[model samples]
Target: MVTKLPLAVLLSASMLLSGCTVVDLDENGQPILPKDPAAKASFSSQTPQQIAQENWDSRVLKGAQDRALTWNDMKNKSTALKAETSSSVFVKATGTVTAVSDDAERERLLTVTINGESVPVAIGPVIRSNAIRDAAGFKFEEFTNQVQFARLTKALNQQNVQQLPKIDGSWVGKPVQLTLAVTLQPQRIEDAVAVVIKQEQP
Candidate 1:
């Protein structure tokens, strides 16, 4: 049925559509602004892409800080090998390395310190994150805080950028699963493995 619309409704819709039109300073009057100059200044900002990039970088840095781990945290927790042998032998290192030859490798070198009498040795393929948990219902992500990362940075020589392996997002809180690809001497590997097993026991 034909009906007459109220003049007020029609005028309001027209005003809204007109407001969206691009106003040219050369043609239209100086850009209409709020009573306060500061409020108006903030409106003329960067494009959407620039804003998104800024937000992404901020989140990435925060995530890196959140997931960062310390040397001791990585040592006591992520080491595949750790044991209180006859001698208090402890090997804690964090970094990435590339094999040079059958018997040689280049270590970017961050930090390494041992308390007991032992040869200073290092191996790579080391990637760690405090984002795991254990069967005992222990959460490891708690160890990835800033305090831990600072300690790790002080103790181990790590690369400028440490890349962690992709873990199933679902398994984060279920069990502690850390993957370390170390190229240790056979004997050292055996020792480290023994230590790690002992530590994990119970």
Candidate 2:
């Protein structure tokens, strides 16, 4: 014999199984929901360049400033500073290029001087790191390896390089403003590589 259930019990069971009590359907049978205003606003406000610049300014620039050191400071207190900070230090310097390395196949290292102390800036061949991204408050676990990080670095490097003068004989004496993310290892400041290099407009 079949047992009949009450209307209220059947409706409750159906609602529980469906996982939704109310579903507003449009004329076309699709869900009728309001557009997300916040999503729309975000989409309209953030351009690719603006987003990238924000990341650069907030993460890369701020990260550098957190433990900033001058060329002379790094030279004299490399060991002490590295031991104290135990992370990459950002170096900001305005200097003229005294020499440019002859290596064309690999990264181009520009030897510049701030108060007569030499600092090398690396340009190209490889721009890979999540240091800036991490500094921008992004977690590495969100990505699969360095692919996204590499893309960010590559775009940044390209934008910076485009604004810089060619690394040739002519660039040897030109003034440049460099902001670098330098690894604090082996107690050497000259081994620092520039993450951003901008030529001072004369």
Candidate 3:
């Protein structure tokens, strides 16, 4: 007499022998579904959910593209194309506060040059510390502005790249470079602070 095996046990045995299906992983860790041969000839195959997911993912990384113009990229592109310097500012200076009478009322405008382009930047006349005083410190207004600049730098660095630029058919065989564009406005901060500027007596 032939005995009938339980349906559940038979299904489990088949699955074990066949091995459960594994999805393929793409470069971005996304699961790539197998393309069906039968579906190739068919029309109207895409679903609404798939379209929605694509749109949602595209919007998430838009900001990364805007803030990623690095100096190296500009320099490299500058060689190939005409590039212009837009914003340059002298963020810090340690020279003696000369002519602090009328100009002391507002921030002093100083010319900052980068790549031979001169940029005018205004710096605060507020003195955080006096040379005559034993303790040296930055003035309140200038100190606050410096803090704001630091925060902006931090925020931009943490941003993610959203969408990459489009590549054409001509460059299909060529290798393309992907780089982070971090354009920091030129600001002369405290690279190294000196308490005293020594001069040799002639």
For each candidate, the alpha-carbon lDDT, in order, equals: 0.30, 0.61, 0.30
Prediction 1 global C-alpha lDDT: 0.30
Over 1-202, each residue of candidate 2 has an lDDT whose tens digit, in order, gives 9999999999999989899547689999998886654443332344435556656656656776676667667555666664435345566778998887675546667888888767666665544443334334445333334555445555655554444445666778889887766555446643455666767899
* Residues forming the 10-long window of minimal summed lDDT in candidate 3: 129-138
What TM-score goes with each of the models?
0.18, 0.50, 0.22
> Per-residue lDDT for 91 in model 1?
30
The positional error of residue 172 in candidate 3, measured at the CA in angstroms, is 50
For model 1, the superposed segments whose C-alpha errors exceed 4 Å read: 1-60, 79-111, 114-202
The whole-model C-alpha lDDT of candidate 3 against the native structure comes to 0.30
What does candidate 2 score on TM? 0.50
Better candidate number, 2 or 3, judged by TM-score: 2
Model 1 C-alpha RMSD to native:
19.6
For candidate 3, write residues 93-161 as lDDT tens digits: 212111212343443333323334333322223222111111111122322244443332322212211
